[model samples]
Target: MKTRLGCLSNKSDSCSDFSEFLPPAQETAARSLKLSTDEAEQWSESFDVLLSHKYGLSAFRAFLKTEFSDENIEFWTACEEYKKIKSSAKLVSKANKIYKEFIDVQAPREVNIDYRTREKTRRCLEDPSPTSLNEVQAKIYSLMEKDSYPRFLRSKMYQDIINRTHAKCQRRSV
Candidate 1:
């Protein structure tokens, strides 16, 4: 099935070659949050750890390029669309369209990877009922509050694992 992140959920199909971008275990829990305002703020707080420090923004951009396939094409398209759109609020929308319509479709091989990433990201925020919320939240928050880039990158696989755990918890709660 197609996942929100535009990747296939099946584990067999790996995404791109940028496996080095995997986040650390401690921070993976927190870094996998949905691409929302809170997540952005959280990322911003750890800008050093996320962007300028190591493979932060560069890694993210690389992953995005792999996920999207054609880097500049879509970004430029989004930029153009963003300019055309009368509403300032549509910037994200324009960008998303650039991602979903152009980028996602351009690369079929990476769809599964995108889906996996999406599914994993969703799982990070969930918990089984109210009981595990504290634990899950704490797990992620702690990682975000502390930790270095190298330490986090070493345990990148945990990002997907943590996502699946959250998904399980959420399903149990539902």
Candidate 2:
């Protein structure tokens, strides 16, 4: 079964497939949202700092895909979205869906979390709230921030964005 990661599509089963399968239009748009020098500086400051911008999050998500840990970010994003559901009915269903998809052991895109965190999240189903997944989400966020975020700063993919954006800025000034 194919796992959906928002608009990104690929024939490969997992995000680790390294093949460049992004649609041309998306690739172009991603490139155009290039990281300016100041943006790069801010991104380097901290993970939360970087994620504040949509472009930064997109670039980081792409980097996570290469590492086969895109599910972590994907789950984190889902939880963030889940928090915004004002309808009690929608909240319950969406919370359950997120748990089954990213927290269940048999889930195709299961995220990495301790048994304790998983159990806590499972318990949240009894009485769903906007903060149902807060604990687990924080764990994933910390994982990305401590482990992946630093590596992403040094990644060629990131450097390329910085370079491209710098060049674009230079061209504009000429």
Candidate 3:
């Protein structure tokens, strides 16, 4: 049986091609989160930590991309941006765009929210508020925290960072 990550195999070629646009991991690691290795481990254990850290968020995004669930994070971030819109007109337009792109049933990047959450979001769009997607976003956040976060902690990518950080620290102390 093909897994979600397995399904992304067809996109690997494109992912590789596009990856060239990504900053080097070292740069991303240093600039993105700015957390120490110990802090990174701690951040990996909690959603709020990861969300607060740019590097944690970037790493999580990379992990989600591998699983083909990057849409969840993307949708959540879009909702955050939508919430920050000051112009009423822009709020409505951006909210609708986000809905059609990630919340709509046939959306190309549909997230794994429940029907009730989806329906609630749709209703919220009728009179869009900054808090419109708050509930659904929380759900998505919980899903990532509970499911993907643990896997990320165990991932080789994460481990390698921890190892490198430890080695660097040891060198400094010695």
Candidate 4:
């Protein structure tokens, strides 16, 4: 089945190279990432914890990319950034941009929202507010929490990080 981000084959070969899932900058940054064992386990505590942690969020985003569902996080993050805009003009412009990119019917990065939520988000573009995208963003957040977050916790990528972190801790204590 096609996911929220884009379609990819089910074969593990499709994403065999983890670097293919991240941009060049992120690949470099992630390569240098050194996550502690304690912090790695803490990410599994909740989706919010994972997102609030720099390395945890990066790893989750990479996992989502491999699953072709990164758009959900991108859109959710964009909505978060959108809410913090203090300028009226900038807020309206960003609202329209976000709508065009994620909420429009044929948006390149359209999220898997129902028609009602999509239309409601669209209507807010006319007179944008800090909370303009709150409803749709909430729906996306719930979807990720219920669906992607669990799979991410169980993903090989996440497991690898935990194992590697544990090994590193062991070496330090040795």
Candidate 5:
């Protein structure tokens, strides 16, 4: 069954219901994102809390897509992946790919960042340290935490999820 939860990739515009492409285990995990009412309510405890929950993160990603600013989250997640590269060659390649895909000016999936942070991130690419994207990623995180995250809490989509989860909980208790 097709669910409303599509656009699981960084490039949201080209995304289809690509959940079908997930490995069986991963697909089961995706389909298993049944957030309880308390879990849904815990989303408002903090932005970090929301991001830490897979269900909350997926919901937030969908919310970001509606706001047309999913790129910020995408960039944030890309930096996360870039930071995990243990091999030097892999690190460099991933850093360059991230820069081209989300950091370079007019990148295909360019994130919203000021020129100063952009330049700083660009300069870091020359040295290509593991922490090269840290500052820029932090900025993006701040942006989402301050701006998008608050709005997400107030979004109708979020409200609907809470209501759905609550209803599910109620029915189970009955």
Candidate 6:
């Protein structure tokens, strides 16, 4: 069966009078997708391929009609609004995904021993002390002027030295 697409004759000088296929939703769809400028142009070509395959010459002529239509200006304007809405939706979806991951992996903070070791090393450098307990305390107090030198060595490595000093102090007290 032969499809009669649009009317065309020598009587009408303007080409706007003829149109008999789907109006260009290609431009509208591309803009609504909020594609980049380069992407939009590439999309236009792809849209033409799809339309041409679907409707052939009839769709091609309809595209010309849209190029000169005053009433369809609103259609193009609506496409821009659709683009904004679609872009915002994508951004919101991405944010929600990150928030969900954060909630899923929520855990309590763990005490970091590496950080503690580094702090202790820095203190030792600032206040170099002798191997003996009394000399170490005197150096720590004289150099840094802080109370309770025994409490400063709280890590497991220094616990034995602190225990020995406590025993010595206990014997002297007796």
- What's model 3's TM-score? 0.78
Residue-wise lDDT of candidate 1 within 79-120, one digit each (tens)?
A: 344555555345445544433543354533222224544444
Residue pair clashes in candidate 5: none
Global lDDT for candidate 2?
A: 0.74
- The candidate with the higher lDDT, 1 or 5, is 5
40-124: candidate 5 lDDT, tens digit per residue: 7999999999988766776787778778898998888888888888998898899999999998999999988899999988898
Candidate 6 lDDT, tens digit per residue, 14-61? 122222233445533332222122321232344333223323223233
Count of backbone collisions within predicted model 6: 0
Model 1 RMSD to the real structure? 19.1
lDDT of 4 by residue, 52-121 (tens): 9876666678778778898999999899899899999999999989998988998999899999888877
Alpha-carbon error at 125 in model 2, in Å? 1.7
RMSD (CA, angstroms), candidate 5: 6.1
| Candidate order (TM-score) | 5, 4, 2, 3, 1, 6
Q: Which pairs in model 1 have colliding backbones?
A: 7-111, 7-114, 7-115, 8-111, 8-112, 24-152
Please, what is the TM-score per model?
0.20, 0.79, 0.78, 0.83, 0.84, 0.14
Considering every candidate listed, which one attains the maximal TM-score?
5
TM-score of 5: 0.84
Candidate lDDT scores, in order, read 0.37, 0.74, 0.72, 0.77, 0.77, 0.29
lDDT of each residue in 1-174, candidate 3, tens digit only: 123122124333211112222356544334333335676677765678877776567667877887778898898889889889999999999988999999999999999988999999999999998899899888988888889888888887566556655655676699
Query: How many pairs of residues in model 1 come into backbone collision?
Result: 6
